[model samples]
Target: MRMRLLVVGLLVAFMALTGCAKNQMSTEPGTQAGENAAVATDSQNSNGLSEQDLADQQRQAMAAAEQEITQNRIYFGFDKFDLDAEAKDVLKTKAEALKAHSEWKMLIEGHCDNRGTEEYNLALGERRARAAYEFLVMLGVPSSNLKIVSFGEERPAVDADNEAAWAKNRRDEFKLFK
Candidate 1:
């Protein structure tokens, strides 16, 4: 009778550890979540996942979101509305990314050097901003996802009256919206 009891206990232990039963199909004979993947779909076959699968999918999604956020910065040139070849290259890359992430939105901030009148600079800045906006729209970024604002000569990047300062001040900056 003692031998029979021991044998029964061993069998129960084996079944529990191996995740094996006549009604279930467990390829790995273990319940280490991902380990016995075969039995996973069975529990959720009608509805889905054992919690672990859902978490993994969420993790992958978050990783992709982070990667997209990392790649989304844009730069511009000095007092220029038209995209130079270099700026176009960069914009192409940005446009492709933005197109891929259709849900993303952007704000384009147009700036100018302090040499001009505030009113004149504001108009110039608007022109510059619109140039970028138009180009981005042409490249497949939806018009609705883009907003343009002109800072005029109000925000001087260098805060100095020099060629270097003017060059740095006149630029279009890109900001992403979550």
Candidate 2:
């Protein structure tokens, strides 16, 4: 244990020295770092794309993401809040879009079939939304940019009492806010 502590202490000292050296270099006269930063702040990037081109690319990506978010619904099995593989893929895309647009927020709406009691369904719906919310946070989407709502059986995607309709109803839907 003493030997391990000695090694850790040495590593920390070395890191501190390295950090000081880096700071000194940055402060030195005629440093390349300042030049590099100036070049970076210029209209043309290292990728050879001008600022206008970069802006156009960003706009195109956001537009594509806007269309892709329509595929954002996450369906689950009856009485289950777990996300399936397909749902995860959909969420991955949603996360990318959310990250792409920093100012955008998402609303995850949880719904259930018209079978369970009102209170129970509401609780279950909340769980479902929380599950998706947690997953989105895990995927690096900010929690502050997300809101959850539980509609329970109040809103059914399909009015039929059949299993197919229930399957469609047991879902979490995504809506965007800018």
Best by TM-score: 2
- Cα miss at 45, model 2 (Å)? 9.6
Model 2 clashing residue pairs (backbone): none
RMSD (CA, Å), each prediction = 12.7, 10.7
Model 2: residue 147 alpha-carbon error in angstroms: 0.7
Model 2 clashes, total count: 0
Write model 1 residue lDDT over 28-106, tens digit each, in one string.
5565644657564557545476577778887887556545434443344654577777667767766776787788887
Model 1 Cα displacement at 49 (Å)? 19
Candidate 1 backbone overlaps, count: 1
Residue 111 in candidate 1 has what lDDT?
A: 85
Lowest-sum lDDT 10-residue window in model 2 = 20-29
Global CA lDDT computed for model 1? 0.76
lDDT tens readout by residue for model 2, 1-178? 9999999999999988777653653633477876766665783577788788899999998878977765558898988999989999999988888898879888889999999899999998999999999998999999999999999999999999999999999999888876
Worst 10 residues of 1 by lDDT: 66-75
TM-score of each: 0.62, 0.67
